[model samples]
Target: MSDPGFRTGPDGVRWRDLNHNGVMDPFEDPRLPDAVRVDDLLGRLGLDEKIGLLFHTVIETGPGGSVLDGPGAISKTGTRHVVVDKRVNHFNVHQLGPAHEAARWHNTVQRLAQETPHGIPVTISTDPRHGFSENAGASFSAGSFSQWPEPLGIAALRDEQVCREYAEAVRSEYVAVGIRAALHPTLDLATEPRWARQLHTFGQDPQVVTELGLAFLEGLQRGRLGPGSVACTAKHFPGGGPQADGEDAHFPYGREQVYGGGHFADHLAPFRPAVEAGVAAMMPYYGMPVGLQLDGEAVPEVGFGFNKRIVTGLLRDELGYDGVVLTDWELVNDNHVGDQVLPARAWGVEHLDAAGRMELLLEAGCDQFGGEECVEVLAGLVADGRVSEQRLDISVRRLLMVKMQLGLFDDPFVDEALADERVGTPATVEAGLAAQAASVTVLADEGGLLPLSGSGRAVYVEGLSAQDAAALGRVVERPEEADLAVIRLAAPHEPRSDLFLEAWFHQGSLEFPPGLPVRLRRIREHCPVVVDVTLDRPAVLGPVMEAVDAVVGSYGSGGPALVRALRGEARGRLPFDLPRSMEQVRTHHPDQPGLGDPLLPCGHGIPLGARV
Candidate 1:
């Protein structure tokens, strides 16, 4: 095998000789302008290589941090096939064990890319991972990363400084692990109280969401896209809330995002700040707009990824955002994992074939397709003279520009040893722990029963382990034998185990199971019950609130943090309103404020010293 080469320029900066021509290409020269570099690189790529840049699919790594040879959970194409044979340069990685392990896997992926002709360093991206939730389809737990509160928890504090601190910590962890793109800072407004994904958003108010969103973007991007930054993708573009009856967009039944409250522009207000903050990417949601009137014209009831009017007209032309626009995952091809098959979220364009869907996405101004690997479908379109190479270049340029802006071409490798030092460092973990403590909103406390002032009382625990409960006071097995009972409960969701990915989504009615009310009543009968419900969604806590002496809303908080919150060492405020009943949730406009006299309104929280 020949030695595939390097060249030194006049300025003494050695270029990779990416084209292997023994001459320095414009794209290989770090000194060249990004536009010239992108153009030069684009010119050297053939049709297959250009199509490869558009697909960003899921990639799984082995226990040793090497690309797996067998099929992964999402993609049928193996790592080698995707990187070498298929020429894919973008991957959304999932399920790596530790920080150092993920870093090693990332370097391995990059090394595989280095073997390609163009030697384009692969961009690794992930959904929100530095959080408490472990939803497989949505987010990962803080495995080796510093864990912070959910996005809603950050909003509850209502402090941009905290958001900045959190983002900086997340940025450091992400960069250390070789994740150059953060697929989050989900700017979707929590106006829709029952939306499953609201845990990922800053809460209801457009103003507050806008402020925190900007701060988060500034922190992640480090005020610009460069070597030290993880490019933030502020998403579910133009806002994904206002779903009819709080149904999410991930399923067929929840495919419509409506604006019945005439607040289309309000939903989009947060993105304005994100764009102003120079977020590197925008991700359109999977839902199609249903009879949404914007700027005196009705938006077509097509999915945002296929809606040219929304993507090109609204985001591009109206808002003046030219950053890379990536569609939410799996809109082009149906995902078949083992025996179960989930249909593509082609939503309004469901009638279209894969080629038609790709054409619509391109026409809608999407630069890349998320969770999709159908490069052959696109290549066929170009071959048939239906789609032009000129169209392909438009997205390819944006994609390459993002890579250059992130300094991926200059240096994509990370120090594997540094990953251990930087990820979940003492300082980062401390900050996260503090945030967790701060975000535990004390929603309802009857007769000031909180701040569990005096310890050594007999305490009965549920949900939390006995050892963890012992820290507060004497732990008891039975509620009847205790002076006080502390019960922990996650917010209720109707379980859907039909589809493979549906279980990951915590959707459906917020009402608790029929047996839960009976159990809680029995517990409270013995002693004053202190209930802490983890508020992933706005849980319908009417029965629990009615029975318990105190109710606390926890968003991604830990056992120690919960104990601290109970002991009055920290403060929290409600990020969004909690409705009184499921009836109100069904009837209320998804975009409006205050859901028919909420049990606890937004910004309602009791500090340790404050009177309840």
Candidate 2:
């Protein structure tokens, strides 16, 4: 057999000689059962190669979708160093270019993997990218892909079909670029209004979250995992909302997750549907539990990724979920970028070294390490008698079985021309825009102040582009000279600059700053003010709602979508309640839902022609 060898079977079908043995192996034959193939391939893998299958980390693409030749900022090493030398086959791809170039990059990486010893195909995964959010640690902005509103927007409509369509769009775009796994459809219920990661959740209602999340899971996996599907990883198992002080667990300051109101069961309610539906994967969050008791047992005070009681006992044994369990990013190692260092999210087990963390995570029943590439650490554990080779085989078998089921063993490359045609097509773009328009929640319209009539009326705007606002009416420099004032405000958060990733998360204090209400009052004195607030998380909006003639809540909708909603072209409802004051927000328990007096309740909305 040559370096790149192929063998013809009795049926005249060509198959890659994965082991280069000149014989058509069972793993190489597409007609064989997936279980038989996985078993055959698993027996052939060496210990170090099996260790590589347990790690999935970030891989950077070069300029114009070329493979990185040398070390880069994110990846910290060259492509061949990680792919061939390290024997890593799983990758999480971020910062992609145009569709055709991204497809070319995918094919390039697959070809590189084909020449390796066993010819294992690379399994590429990604965070949610088809939305307006652009946090580097979380999600990316929809660059060339079809753009839609946030997951909160999909939940606001409360339509399962719409959620399915949005997920189907995401699946189509991801599959075109050779992405096999989707790390999203976050089932975390947004019970804590101040949590920074709420934009990706469904809502506070467990029933709504369960129904819509299952639809989204089905859409992405296309009824089952196969060649045409992008496997969905329903995430943050046992829930990630209810952070202490609503701060994210990405930083050290927000490491604790408290269930003071005894609502842990409510938070765990949504994940049952995903488990029952046979979701392809699960991701435990980075937050550690504090004084939490589940089913008459006190859960260990560790991050969910390192808690065996949570991952193995609850998710696997109790829920009967046999899917792959992937830990959230960077649970085992610290991340250093430029002049800053983010310590490992070991949480309660901060004293352990990298190798100790790997051993504990495997014992916790997780299958793969997210955002980590320390194959040497895991290999050393095996050598030191801490981790047995049989334990390594368990995870490797699960990982390889997923790759086979996704049809990556048969063909992993994608057509560049087809990717260009399928991604961000006119139909997908229109559907996304329509969903964005439909997700606009009209909270208030006092005395019928919305649906502005003619286009010639003078309009004054703030926080909106002049080009997009021009479609409604003539743009004016000041509110005094215009017939109406349109202001776009983001739900408030106290800014923090202490940590590197903390600044990106909008945490602490949903109250509006002191000057905002006064500024809105001044603008309203000159002309009737209509305010649109982007509710990534629910806000305390009593003052602004009182001053403005109309208040509309937007869940990541763009300028054009807002204009369409204001012009009576779309309709939406509130997904969660808006607090009346900071006092109310403070007094309400973070883990409980619908327990306090709110300015506007969930499911509250005023239609375009209706008066509040």
Q: What is the lDDT of every predicted structure here?
A: 0.86, 0.88
lDDT of 2 at 78: 84
Model 2 residue 38 CA deviation (Å) reads: 0.2
Q: Please, what are the lDDT tens digits per residue for candidate 2 over residues 1-612?
A: 123345667788977777667787889888899999999999888887898899899898899878998867777568888898888999998899999999988888887787677889899999999999988788999999999989999988898888988988999999999999999889998888889999999888888888999999999898867999988888898999888888889988888998999899888998998888878899999999999998788999999999999999999999998889999999888987767888998999999999989899999999999989999999889999999999998899889988999989888878898998999999999999988988898888776777766688889999899898998899999999988899999999999986666788998999998889999999988989999999999998888888889999988888998898788755778888888877787777778876467888888876663521
Winner by TM-score: 2
lDDT score at residue 489, model 1, on the 0-100 scale: 93
Misplaced by over 4 Å in model 1 are 1-14, 609-612
Report the error of model 1 at residue 535, Å: 0.7
| Candidate 2 to truth, TM | 0.97
Q: What is the lDDT of residue 350 in candidate 1?
A: 92
